[model samples]
Target: MTEQPRLTTREAAQRLGVKPETVYAYVSRGQLSSERAPGGRGSTFDAREVDALAGRGSRREPGTGGASGASGELSFRTGITLIDKDRYYFRGVDAVELATAYGFEDVAEWVWTGEPAHGSRFTAPQQFLDAARLAVDALPVHSSSMDRLRVAAVATAAADPLRFDLDPSAVLACGRMLIPTLVGALPTVGQHRSGEGRLARQLWQRLTSQLPDEASIRLLDTALALLIDHDLAASTLAARIAASARAHPYAVVSAGLGVLEGPLHGAASGLAHRTLAEVLERGGAAPVVADHLRSGRRVPGLGHRLYPGEDPRATALFALLGAIPQAADALAAARDVVDTTARHTALHANVDLALAVMSVAFGMPAEAGETVFAVARTAGWLAHALEEYAERPLRMRPSGHYTGPRPPRPLPA
Candidate 1:
């Protein structure tokens, strides 16, 4: 049997001369049809339908104009989070302020249920903890923290018979348990703390060999809250797509983790870490910035597509770091890099830069920022999954526009 030709979203976007999000908008409106590619990689559009849509030069409805890689403009509605030119909002509250005022567990409950939480606590079940530990220990000793997280998610699902429950309340409850378990499952280089605090405190214990003071732990919490959700990132879309199929909550998280492991997404912070490390080792920020430009490479941790002037998250994190006397040197290096990068180009330091700065300032491992992002983003993913579950299932399938020659003359049958 001959397989029908198809176009990926990126290819369809090019054919129609529209953004990728616009292509998704077309799918959402039923202007185009799509199906899951082999292995459920992503949706593929009918090539013929896409070509037809492209010929017509489709335009989305007004008032929906915003950048999104998955859903078109505002074609898909999400009450979870909003991103503007300067600030990110989670359910009408400023994310930076929210982070400062509350722990990430509170942020998780708020975004997932749309209500501020009072004294919420997250703890892993003993059985789930034992299972997660077995799973984590099964991985190679050199596996990244994210690798452990992925394994833990799958293990958690397998251990929970009720994981298939799709009710919002059940899903939210799973999140409350899953977040802490996921953090606990990681390989902690330091001495484990005996008492309990928040997720960030526990996570800090996992990532570093040193004990963190109250101020440092608070900064880590703020960072986690700030990273909780940001509209529909690639990983979020992956999570939603999985949820749209009614996959288990743990499976939804697995989908998100799969996408986040990509270099261009979650791993981008590690790149920024390397860049900043170079600046410190060279004893001058300007030289490294100039070299990156001369090589025509993007200065890692700098520039963002959505925010023109600055990343408010970056501003907030930097402010927190500035207030901590222990972070003075790390803060100064970050500023120098920012200054040099700005002088050479219009780019501004973004959240990735901030994450890298935080990790460096706190003496964490190279991928610690990525780990934080993955953990924090799980809250957003689960929220999006809930939203997708409420909508019609399998609505994310995208139709492709065929551009190839007519089917091989019927295979000369």
Candidate 2:
């Protein structure tokens, strides 16, 4: 095997399509590690490392190796969804069937509390509702749903009169109550002292106000089923860790939302919307894709990490999104591209790419795609949070190395 020749930082910058200053910044930031060439002259960097650093953008900078004889963990990127037959139960239930027949509230409870399919979210006690409302009101309206939940967590912790009710079952109920207020809708009519209202009913009643049409509720329901509970994803793991801490339902949910804000997990929906908008601005799908390919651009909806084949969720949602009248022309255009661009890979649409088209066709605000994803994915977070609470907590202490010289003692002093 041949060892590849190293490149100067200047050459690496040219390959990365970034400025020389950006390349230097990457080095200083420990993103693009450099080698001291034989003469100890100007730095040389690995070309592959520089290329990777350019794509990494603003994510958590990569960590160095583990301590003596210890290995760090690596997770495979299975985009959008996960099916864990050994541990999880997605295979047993028909998600599309439930999404179509039930309203969003039923699915919400199903994911969070693992209640029966037809079960109600109304079972949460009045005290939980009171805590949720107080938390919602305490939020700065400018905050996202994820942010509002953290505010709710502190309020929930402050208000929970019960000192000993720290188990998974109780905490999960709190999650169901919290979701409606944080993401989709909030109950407005509650008296500070009213008896327990239907959590599902109040949510649906409020949802109808923001999204009056039946179709929006249906769409919201489908979205939840599609996005909920992908197994053991990084964001899911973060949620689980928070849950393992016996964080109250509010804290656990907040933690999950925080994890979802990352691009690798959750921000792809918004990016897809951006991609779709640019394509539409260019007229139709074919020319837009052709131009993008010619310019070395990525087409958002056309690829996935998990399903090298067609994503089942993407096929399902496109059917729902395509039914709307405004989507007809664009949907037709997309299909035409799919047929003609078979050369682009027999790739079927992935969830985010389909969602980009749906966001525009459904008349959702550009940011609403992410907002909706946060809402849908919260159900999965709660489920993982509940799972976390059931397990004994791991303190997540990983070992490390000290590369510096050892024990110089008081000689320097």
Candidate 3:
């Protein structure tokens, strides 16, 4: 086969109408692949791939009011997190910094109220916790963690007479209670520590039987904080839509949970966990990656559309996981997967991969990452719901673009 001509990084960036850094981001995201130059100095990309990507970008006509062209975009003003240049910020503060410096409860409180509530805690009311647990326990033995959470949300809503109250204070109160209830409802693998002071400590008992060290607990706490919100994720959007329809806080959470079942979203970590476990068992990433590709499945936990470069969440968690001596093997397994996949398509590890590392390292089940995601993201769903509630009701309803047979002509048999 004749060798294909290649474009240098600068030329690729120019061809794609993006910066050199963005070209590198494209490589990291697996949107484009690059190879080391002959002398191993700089990277080069296939000319065809760069042109193809540019062609895709050019499809959207400029000045059409939205990135999708004439149909426009559904945009809402949000004072929450902002993602820019591979870094995300929560209310103007760096999310990674906030997560590292403060506990999940404190960070969630800050995201909710725009000010840090030092030493903040989320405690489930006995009534709500009991209701949620009863609902979760009633499920079949084979039910997944997300199934329990969805049912718990409904049960907690039924138990709360004040759930209909949409006042900001009332909603905030519900958020504080609801988060803990969700965590408390899960079946504990070990002896339940119901009275643990920190939410992280409380959740620790439910996730694994092994006693957690200080560093492990800190890792869990940071993971929760980092995941608290990520601007308009699919589940967050679902929650906002429900809130736009005046659904109660618990219903808003239910809406979010409803969307979390998709393989691409909250369940992604579970998939990644299984993959990592397989890699550990198989003893190498090559055959596993090959199997995944041969089956036509994009390796889960590899790339994220929002982050072109490295996922900041993964970077932070990997840093923390590095400090933990027990995580070394799982961490090495994760790196091997990333490195192996990179040879074919340059993709960076996303948060799902990091979550997988934690789950695999701590002897947690495959679904454990999903459980953690559901519990942590519940706070974010509520935060978005609160914002949506303040807007004009039903504002999210958009007119569907009618593409079928023109109105009267569609009345045929």
Question: TM-scores of all models?
Answer: 0.84, 0.65, 0.82
Residue 316, candidate 1: C-alpha displacement in angstroms: 1.0
**Model 3 reaches what TM-score against the true structure?**
0.82
The digit string of per-residue lDDT tens for model 3 on 1-413 reads: 88778999998877766668777766665667788999999999998877776655422454321122222233556788999979999999999999999999999998998976899988898989999999899899999888998999999999999899999899999999998898889888876555468888988888889889899999999999999999888898899999999999999999999998887789999989999999999998888999999999888789888899989999999999999999998999899999999999989999999999999999999888888888889989889888989888976554332336655555557
1-413 per-residue lDDT for model 2 (tens digits): 57668989688777766566766776664556788877998888876676554444322222221111111132322222335321223434555565566655676666655566564553444565477667677666676544554565555556666523667666665566555545322433223232234333333343223332445445555766666766666777777667667766666666777777776667776766765676567766788678768998666666666666666666777788667766675566556545545777676666776666666665554545565566666677767665555555654333222345778656764
* Ranking of candidates on lDDT, top first: 3, 1, 2
Output the lDDT of residue 159, model 1.
92
Mark the 10 consecutive residues where model 3 has the least summed lDDT: 63-72
Better of 2 and 3 by lDDT: 3
lDDT of 1 by residue, 225-312 (tens): 9998998888998898899899989999999999999999999889888877888888878888889888998888888888997799
Alpha-carbon error at 164 in model 2, in Å? 7.8
Pairs of residues at least 3 apart in sequence or in different chains that clash in candidate 3 = none
Using alpha carbons, what is the TM-score of model 2?
A: 0.65
- 275: Cα error in model 3, Å: 0.9
